[model samples]
Target: MRSLVQILAAVKELRWYYWGIIICSLLTAATSLLTPFIIKEATDEVVASLQGRGGGISVVLWLAVALLIADLSNTIISNVGGYLGDVMAARLRTRLSQRYFHKLLTLPQRYYDTALTGTVISRLNRSITETTQFMQSASNNFFPMMLTLVASLAITAWYSPWISVMLLVVFPTYMWLTTLTSKRWQKLEAKKNSHVDIAGGRFAEVIGQIRVVKSFVQEKRELASFSDHYDATIGLTRSQSRYWHSMDAARRGAMNLIFFGIHALIFVRTVQGAFTVGVMVLLIQLVNLAKQPAMMMSYLVDTAQRAIAGSRDYFEVMAEEQERDELADPVVGGRRELAPDEPMIEFRDATFGYEDGVDVVHDVSFAIRQGERVAFVGESGGGKTTLVSLLLGLYQLRSGQVRVAGHSIDQTPAELLRGSVGVVFQDASLFSGSIRENISYAHPGASDAEIEQAAREANAHDFIMGFEQGYDTLIGERGLKLSGGQKQRIAVARAMLKDAPILVLDEATSALDSKSERLVQQGLDRLMKGRTSVIIAHRLSTIASVDRIVTLKDGQVDEIGTPEELARSGGIYAELLALQSGSKQDRKKLKNFDITA
Candidate 1:
């Protein structure tokens, strides 16, 4: 959660695995150094035997046995360490990914509104996979390599100080160069990832709305745009690959030259009789062992840098302010109490907007008593939906007050109102689930019988049974597999299952054809009875039976009366009704009615 090493090290459950890594690394290094010593011993033994020295064969036999044990144990321990590293990496991935997912769920609506789904998904995927790999790389590769280097260097220094001096001088320079190259690569790699994210977002956006694309005949245009993004991403990736290859080649070239020089020096020393051939062989082996870790350092450094960058992006999302869960906290010195018998719903001078100082629902004041069927009719953007959103506590008030069930909304717990008010939105949003599942969504533990009854009441039972799978039929994404009316009926079934004491329907049946609308309206009428209902509709006939109609214009209430009274008033409502009443031919003669205009 912090720096790469700190984050990995902080996993308490992996503490034992980390200890195993350290112990196994040390053991592996010890065994690795022992093999080269045994080689030196065998070489010495063969030289002594050729010179007719005593116990030469037995000495070689002992060294061979030691060599076998060292190499086998080293292999076994390294595998064990690698296994432990994988386990730790998997745990880290699971825990952090879960945390990120939960954080995503907690984020406010504004984040979802602005962030592209593809970009968010890409970041989430990389953050978990890359970060864990970076940690595992450090633990299994980087740390073990460092241990090997230390063990090999110690042996080399003990045998030959002159050789140790050369290693000290060349190795640090090599490491510094690798680090510098890795830093540059990390930056370029991050840039490449950005381009990839942009391309992914573009791709997802176009594909998700494929229907609209074909309808508008913009497939060719969308393809051109996506191609442009993808090409840019490919260009950035190619540049990054070029830099990586160049750095790798340069590192190898430098390493080969340095090692060759060291070998040449060792050969000269041996020829001058300064050291035996055995000593020369051991130094060479040690140098090679040390070089292995040094070479791995570059790749590990690159991974660490990339992980840091990815984690930063990941944590940045996690740091966003989450939606408030307080339900309601009353304002200081404001109304702290309410009458138990007050109207079921009241909005007193309530003003709010998505932005400050620009009210969408301006100074709106109204009240609906228990069991009242009140309808709100307004043109688009006249704040009909916004008002409903306010009542549902989807928004905070900029001014005034909203009271529900005899309690000030700011003082009442949100769950209290949420549990009491059932809403069927215009879109009838449904998940990719079975019909029974969708109906039970409002009440997850609802019995099958209860679900069936709700579906029957919503008039969705007949159509639902017509499917081969009946209630178990899989609805495609957003229930696209179902017809518009089917989805609406299922939505109503969901609301009916909730059996809330209050209901709000925002153009719930607006999208259905005449026959579908009639069927859905019948269910809606049953749902609205014996409850405090708020209906927002554009089709005047659908709401003609409501007890009262509140008309809005330019963010204020323009009229409030029974449908009969409003029709007789010759106001905006009367004009709208007359316009709809005209014959199809006559309607074409009149201009379209726009209340806002």
Candidate 2:
């Protein structure tokens, strides 16, 4: 209950609805308190009729009407309070979901590399539902119970001071029992929620990679793993339920003792002629009202514990500091004005890695003149992709500087830096949407004619038109429905639609078949015509037409020259060319040179 109050307090912007809930709750409680008084009045009239003194049927009629009015008001107002509570829950859920998504957008690349996709999704989905359920319980059950208990005690104290005093004593003991039970339940609920998360994460993982399960014929194994997680969750839930019911039994036993004591006190007072039968009836009704709060104690505590567990998870994500952009400060914005002869891209003593104090790309320096096509050739794990990531502002520099058209990458806004450069990766990413949507991703407002033109330039127009739905074709998840060559062409067409001044081809055509490679390469050639291009390639043949081939070894520049010049120089580039061309004589010469060195 305390935790639920804290949650409501933190969301102070919804105070107006909170006030509505409070008002309706108070009205319902007031109406309920009137029932005992009405019952007492009708009882006195019945006694008078039985004794044959001042027996008036009209008085009984008036009391019955009053009881009906009180009940009707209580029912209507309680429903209204329930409705307003749901409204509050909906708003809180929306605000939380929006915050989680917005934080995701602001998080740095390193977090994504380490975080599990399924776990994150499960956390976000569960937190909202659990928190809202708690709110509903608190509003509909806990709040009304407290109000009615308090109101009943005050009226009873005014009428029969002794009975009220006895109930007051029992009240604190019942609350103490509830408090102890809540603490233990909270710990158990936390453990239970973790099992739930594991189950949800596994479910999402299986759905996301169903193809792998089918290929490996591991469906039985996967099912067994999921069953283990589900069993753990159910086991924990059953344990919690058993513990709750035990505590509830104790609470009910204590309430029975209090009820018996109160009834005895009323009977003695009536026998002593200090109280009438009508007053005893009223005292009995008040005792029942007092028991109501204690009876609801288990439910309220369980809900509060669950709510606290969920809110803790939700706020933990919210507490993560959003990744701050180095270039967040305002700057004079325009097409970075540079001298006509200045280099379009430059890296000077640039050193970077995902972690601090360890540089995978160390002390590397190079430059590409405007409109010059350059290719970077390197072995696996030679930091080729890291360099491209730096250019796109996906990472911050550990030391030194990288610039595009004389503008420092660290000082330029990430969106602006990425907007000026276009990229087509080896694995083309396409969402489950229409072909037209994927093509116009960078320029969502692009007209049909403009999209068609871009597709034509990328050699994708004919293939796209061949589909029954043409541009409206719904590609399955990640464009799996399309052939490798077809997916690559659509990716190329998307980049072409951006029409940026600089283009990056990250081994885009490396995985295609010979025929697919030819088609994709044709699209690539058209896309790179007027743009300053940087091609990261493994194949020597694909980069032959580039103005310069820069060979990297152990994170340093080993050679940079025209392909023909590098082939004659007999350095890393020439050796790589020799190995790929499968020249036996050159391999023997290189092996002999390596032993001598």
Candidate 3:
């Protein structure tokens, strides 16, 4: 019921169109009712003329003409009303689709952390399609069906109250039976939807990582798993269908029996002279008209239930809390300038975690001066990436504050804060597009010359120029067509084009081959110049040139000093370095610490 109200409220802005449909339906109902009365008059006129007491065939001819006109008018009004309903349905679809997409955009990153991309997309498609179709069906058919039923009942009651009462029983009984099964049907549908969503999510994941699946020889297993979900849906559908049709059959049988009595009542009344033959014909036609809505009751209820289910799912996502935009200040034009003495990035006693009471980074305090290159080295899952995420304002700290350019992160707009930082992750994460689009992503308005200049600085221009289309060359999904080195270089060029005041190199060259690493590192070097750079790398050699290195251990700041100072202090940094040294002496030294080389 709540979902139905929400669906109605969603399309309230187009009430004028709805009103037009209502008017057309009313006219159609009135015109349709005229047909039975006209037929009765024509029958009576023919009978009177045949009995030699009529005003001849002229009256019947005129009634025939009137019937034709009513039929034509009914057709036109119904068509016009259908067209209006179609337009309204389409508009509702557009309105709801745009709102859903906008909500997806405004949602926080944390929402995506546990959301499946395929499931999210599936919800949008299924919910909107079902809702729109139901709306269209209701507008085009439901109102007319209802109006015809009501008018038929009133006319039938005027002739004989018993027939009208019997017709009324048909509808309420059918509806009650439908209402009994609707809950169970909807539950089954929801369960089926779960299976389908999971399958869809897995389908997308498999397609996205087809190479992994193939390489692992799990193609058969994946195919079987995918088929299993559909099989489960089929099973649920069988039960759902059986339950619905069984109840529908029972409703229909009861309706048929009542209608049988209605037909008998009309016939017997005419035979007993209580009703004229013409009146009997009119009542029979009215009964047939009323039967239309009664028979259609089940279908309408089915559509309503599907729509309610879909709307409930759609509104569930919309009801999710969106990121608060009012709390952060807006960015003006370009990046804000920072004073030379100001720390470009600051984290004071920062603590954070993905889950409550499980802090990933604890009591971590640090400051990076403008243009200073700092590196963070730690074991896997030691909160290295989490810190960078916090710094970039991707996640809020638990108890402490992080500031960028003297503005607290919590008070700064995410876009404004992120606009001041350029990051090159381990994965290039490039979309499928032309080289020009990928390179100009960070600065879409960049000129050809500016794009080339950034690419050249990243050592990508030469390789890109070698292609037939140069910057126009198409790179497939995630830059699968390019070598690891080429992709990283493009990412570096992107960061370079951004020209933000701060840079973060998160294992930027970790995945590249030695030769590719050299090329990408050259680009990283030029990109990092004059920026407050935060580096996270497992390779100690990569950070050898950093001004300072902060070592993290078990979610705490284990050491913070110059690279040389931390190396000699024999903490997590020295242990990591010794492990990477690959010498017998370094391997023997690992025994002194709680680590293995």
Candidate 4:
């Protein structure tokens, strides 16, 4: 009920439309009610005329015209109301979609870590679609049905109070039955939705990683898993449908029996001359009118239950806490100046984990001076990427703080903090778009000359020009259309175009062949110049030129010094350097520390 109320409150802007729809519905109901009364008048007049005591055929014709006009009015108003309902529903969908999209953007990154792309999309689509459809249906049907039922009962009561009493009795009984069915139906729906969401999530994963699946030849396995989920839903549906329809049949049977008694009573009263034949016709029509709502009660209950379930799902995401933005002073033009003495980036005793109580980055501390280049080197799972992610403000620290450009990340606005840094991840996370669009993603307003210049600096200009569309060439999803080196170079170009004061390179060139690595490394070298750069690399040769090296082991910083100093000191960095130099003895010694080459 609260979820339904929230849905209504969300569309307050469309209240006038709702009011108009209600007015039309009321008017429609009023026009429809006039038909039976007009028929009753015409019938009595015809009976009197046949007995030579009334005005004759002319009165019947006039009343027939009145009935036509009433029905026409009812039809026109009902259609107009339906049109307004449709418009309201479409506009409501737009507003709710925008709101949900905005909430997704503002949600913390952690929310997405375990969230599946397809499941999230499915939830958004299904929930909003269900809610919008229900509101539209309610606007078109609910009020008209209620008004017709009430007006019919009131008129019936005027003629026969006992008949009206029977009509009233049908409602609560129908409602009680529907309520029971709806609760069980909603539970089954929720369970079905869980299976659907999982299937949808896995479907998207399989499609996106189709290449991986094909390479490993797991097509049959994935298909079986996907089919298994759907098969489970089918079983549940069979049970759910049987239960719903069976209950509906029983409810309808009970309603028919009660109406049978009411009809028989009306017939006996007319035959006994307690009521006129015209009055009998009117009462019968009114009974049928009242029955309409009672018949539709089950359908309305089903729709309402769906809306409630969808609303709960939609609001669950909306209720998640948004990322905090405490912008005391917004950074002007997306960059902040750093004092000469202050570090360009600093992590003070930083500790963090993807989950609580199991820290991935321990109490690590480091700082990079302005324009100094540093590289983080360690074995896999050593928290190098995690540390860089902290600097990027992607995750909050479990303890301590990360300051970028003299602003504490926790206290700074995300846009301000992130806008000051540029990153080139190991995977070139390019979207499905043209090359120009991807290059200018960070700075959408970048001019063509600026774009070409950045591409040139990243060594991507020659290859990009090789294509027919050059910069305008389309890159498929995740840059699938391009080679690994080409994609990495484009990512580098994107980072260069951002031109932020701080830079992060997370194994940017590690995934490429020797020739491709050289090309990308050259671009990295150009990008790192005159900027404070934090690099994560497993390749030892790349960090030789860096001003300092930070080696992590088991989430703690084991060594922090110049590469030459670490090499001489024989720490983890030294052992890694020796292993890379093909020293078998060093490999055996490093294995004792759980460091792999």
Listed in order, each prediction's TM-score against the native is 0.86, 0.89, 0.92, 0.94
Q: Mind giving the per-residue lDDT tens digits that candidate 1 earns over 321-421?
A: 87566555543333233355688889999988774458888889889988999988766678887888788776778899998866776766556667778
Q: Which tens-of-lDDT digit does each residue in 1-597 have in candidate 3?
A: 678668778768988998999999999899999999999988877888899977787888899999999999999999999999999999999999999999998887788889998899888888888889988998898889789989999888887888889988887788788879988999999999899888998898899999999999999999999999999999999999999999999999999999999998888889999987788888888888888877877888888888888999999999999876745454546665565677888889999887555888889998999899998877666788888888877776779999888778888777788889999999899989999999899899999999999999999999999999899999999899999999999999999999998999988988888999999999999999988899988766689999999888888888999978987998888787767677886776544332110
Ten consecutive residues with minimal summed lDDT in candidate 2? 588-597
Question: Can you tell me which runs of candidate 1 are displaced by over 4 Å?
Answer: 1-3, 6-16, 54-59, 161-175, 178-187, 247-252, 272-275, 325-339, 355-357, 392-403, 406-420, 564-572, 582-597
The residue pairs that clash in candidate 4, if any, are none
Q: Which residue pairs of candidate 1 clash?
A: none
Cand. 2 Cα-lDDT: 0.83
**Reference-based lDDT, residue 135, model 3:** 84
- Ranked candidates, highest lDDT first: 4, 3, 2, 1
What lDDT would candidate 4 get against the real structure? 0.88
Alpha-carbon lDDT, every model? 0.81, 0.83, 0.87, 0.88
**Which candidate has the highest lDDT of all?**
4
lDDT of 3 at 2: 79
Give per-residue CA lDDT, model 2, range 1-597, as digits (tens): 455566677778889988999998899889888898899889988998888874588878988999999999999999999999888889977877887888888777877777777777888888777888878777776788789889888988987888888888776777787776777777878787777677777778788789999999999998998788778878877887888788878877887787788899889988999888888898888788877877777666666677778888877777776655646534344356556777999999998877554678888899998888998877666777778888887777788889998878878877778888999999889888999999999999999999999999889999999999999999999998999999999999999999888999998988899999898999999999999999987766688899998877777788899988998999877877777677776555433222100
RMSD of each: 4.3, 4.2, 3.1, 2.5
